[model samples]
Target: MYNLGGSVYWNRKTFKKWFATRPINLKWMLLVILVFPMFAATWEMKKSSGFSPLQLLGLLVFAFAFMSIISKKTKAPNLFFLFYVFLFLLITNLLLVFFYEGSFSQFGDTIRTILPFLLFFYFRKHLNSVIDIEGFLITFLIASVFPISTLYYEILFNPIREVYNTASRGGGLRLSGFYADLFGYMSHLICGFICYCYFYIKYSKRKSKHFIFSNVGFLFVLLICLIGIYNLRHQASWAVSLILLSMFVYFIRKQVSAFQLFVFFIIALGVGGYFYTQIFETLFAKDIAVYEGGAKETAALNGRVYLWKKYYAFWENFNVLGQWIGAGFAQHEKSSVMMSGGMHNDYVRFFFSTGIIGILCYVSFLIYLIKKTLKTRIVEFKFLLLASVIVILMYSISALPLLASGALMYFVVAIASQINKNIV
Candidate 1:
C-alpha cells in the first residue's frame, strides 16, 4: 500500500512480489515530502487553478498520504483522516467558485496552509524511518538544486525585474529564485545552511565517504547558502543568521583555541568593514530610511507594528465564536494583506486563519515537541530538534515560519527520531 514511497527489493521474482502490500516506507515518504512542490517552483507555468506544478504535486501528496492512512488500517482514525482531506478539497473548490469569485490565487493560498500540517502529521505518525539522518541529509542536498539553481540563474541571466519571477526590494535584487516570493526561498536557505554545516562538521571529525560530505564542494555549497541569504536581505534573515551562527559556535566550542577564534573574528571584521558601505547599506538600506523618519517602533520592526495594529483592530471586531475558531481560510483572505500573503507575523496569520483554537493546538504541539527534545539521548538529534524549534519561534515573530517546509521538516524528522533509539 505504501509502494509509492517505500523501497522494494529487485530480483527475478520482483514483478511477482510487486503486488505485496507494504507498510509505509517512512524514509522515502520523507524524501518525497521534502523534495517535491517547492522544487516545482522552478517551473511554475501558470497562476490559474490546477495548472501549477506545485498545486499538482501538493494534491498528489495529499491524496497519497491520506490513502496511506486508509490502507494501513481500516478504522475510525483512518476514515476520519481520509474524509478530512476530501472535505477540504470539496470546500476549497466551492469556496473558489463563490467566496473567492474563482480566484486561483486564493485557491493556492488555502492549499499551501493545509499541505504543511499534513506533511508534519504524516511524518510524525510513521516514526521508525525518520532515523536515517545521513540518508535524509543527502536527499536534502540533492533536492536543494531546485531552489539554489534559481539563485544562480538569476545571477547569471540577470532577468528583467519587471516581468520575471525575480523578487526585488530596497533597491536590491533578492535571491528569491523560483519561489513566488522571498520568504519561501529564504526559508529554504536556512535549511540548506544547517545541512551544509552538518556535513562539514561530520567530515572534520574524521575521514568519510565522498558523497556524505566533500571538503571542497562542502565549502562551495556553504558559500551559496550564505550568499543567497545575504542577497535576500530580510530582517528575519539577519535574526536567523545570528541564531545559526551562535548555535554553530556553541556546538564547536571545544574544538577551537581562543587565539584561533580571535583571529577568525578579526579577519571577518576586517573583510566586512573593508566594504562597510556596500554591505551595510545593502542590508539596512530600508531600515535606515524608516529610522530617519523618527518612527522608532515602525522602523525597528519594518512596519510590522503598523500592520499588527490593523490586524488587532480587525480581530477585535470578530464575534465571540469567530474570535475563538477563526474566520476560515477563504473568509480571512478578504483582507488585501492576507491575500497577498503578508501578515508580517505568524501569530497574526494564525489569528486570522485559524483563531484561538488553532493557535492553542499549535502551541500545545510545540510544548510536546520540547518535551520530546529533552527526552532524546542522541546529542546530534537533540541539537537539530532544538535548533529547528528555535528557528521556528524566532522566525515566527517577523515571518511565516510555519509555512516554510525548510523550518518544519526538521522538526518532523526530530519527532520521528524520538520514537526510535537506534535511528541514527
Candidate 2:
C-alpha cells in the first residue's frame, strides 16, 4: 500500500506484532485529533464547488498520512503553537463576530485554513524517520507548485488584466491562486520557494537520482515566482523577496561570494532604478497625468501607511490580557475606519492577542528550537533554517499567507525542524 519514494516494512503480521509492542504516546494521540481532521474535511469537500487552501492542505495531509500509515510509520512531530494560535484566534474571533458584528463566518475561513498546520504541529514531535521528513517536505512543495504556477501564468500574461484594469486605489490586480485571494497565495509561494532552494542546495551533493531534475525544477519554479511577483506589482512581494533572498545569502555565505553578492545588488539597483524612473516620470510629468493626480494611484501605499497608524492606535486598547488572549485572536479592530485583520504587524498581533506571555512563549519556543536546530551539522538544516528566518522576516512587512497554505508554511518549519532535530 505504501511504495512511493521509499518503502515501509509492514505486513499484517508485522503490524500485529508492532501493535503489541508499540507504546501509546499521549502527545501522538492529541495530535491525531487536532491535525487529522483537516485532511478528513478536505476529502469530504474534494468534489465541492469552492475548496479553500485549508481544504487543499487538509487533503494533502490525508494523502501524506495515508502513505505513512501504509508504510507502518508512527505519527509525525507536533508543532502545536500554530494550532494553538489558530484555535485561540478562532474562538476569540467567533466571539467577536457573534457578540459584536454578527459576522459568524468571518473567522471561519481562516480557522479552516489553519487546520493543516495545526495538524503539522501536533505531530512535530513524532516525526522520527527520514521517510517522514522527506515525505512531508516533498508533499508540501508538490502541493504549492501547482496553484502558484497558475497565478504566475495569469499575472505574466495578464490574460484579462483585471487587477491592472480594475483601477483599484489600494491593491493592484489581486492574484488569487487556487485559494480565494492573491496576497496570501503569493506570500506562501515566496516562502515555499525559499525553502525549496534551501533543500535543493542541501541535497545537491547527495547524488540521488532525483537531485538533477529536482534542482532544475526548483530553479524553474523560482523563476516563475520571480516573474509573478514582478507582474503582480505588489510591494509586499518585493519586500518578501528581498528578505528571503537576503536570508538565503546570509545563511549560505559559503555558497555565495562577495562578487556574486555585488553583482546581485547591482542588478537589483538597476531594476529598481528603472522602475523608479518610470514612477517618477508618471507622478511629476507636467502634461501627461497617467495616474491623474498620483494620489489615487498610490492609494494602496497610503492605505498601508494609514493602517499602520490605526494599528498603533488600536494597541492602546489591549493592556495585559489583551496581549495574553490576543485581543481575541484573528484580528483586533479599532474603529470601522481603522480595521485590523491578518495581524499586519507580528509583534503587535502577538502583543495584542496572545499577550506578552504568549509572545514570550512563542519567542522562547523559536529561540530554543533555533538553538536546537543550529546544533545539527547538516548543511540542509542550516539552509532550511535560513529560509524559515527569511519567511518570518517577510511576515514583518507583509502577511505572507502563512495560514492560507498550511503545507507551504508547515513544510518550511518541518524541514528546518527535522534538520534541527537530526531527523532529516
TM-score of each: 0.70, 0.60
Instruction: Give lDDT for model 2.
Output: 0.49
Model 1, 174-276: lDDT tens per residue?
A: 5555566665466457776776555444433444345434434644655676677666656566667656755655654454457645543554454345335
In terms of TM-score, the best-performing candidate is 1
Write candidate 2's Cα lDDT for 277-336 as tens digits: 644343234212334664533243424545565565665665554545555533445421
Q: Cα lDDT for residue 415, model 2? A: 45
Clashes of 1: 0
Q: What's every prediction's RMSD, in angstroms?
A: 7.5, 8.8
Q: For candidate 1, give the lDDT.
A: 0.54
Which parts of model 1 are misplaced by more than 4 Å? 1-39, 42-44, 48-50, 72-108, 127-131, 156-169, 183-188, 202-204, 207-221, 255-282, 285-293, 296-300, 328-340, 357-361, 404-424
Candidate 1 colliding pairs: none
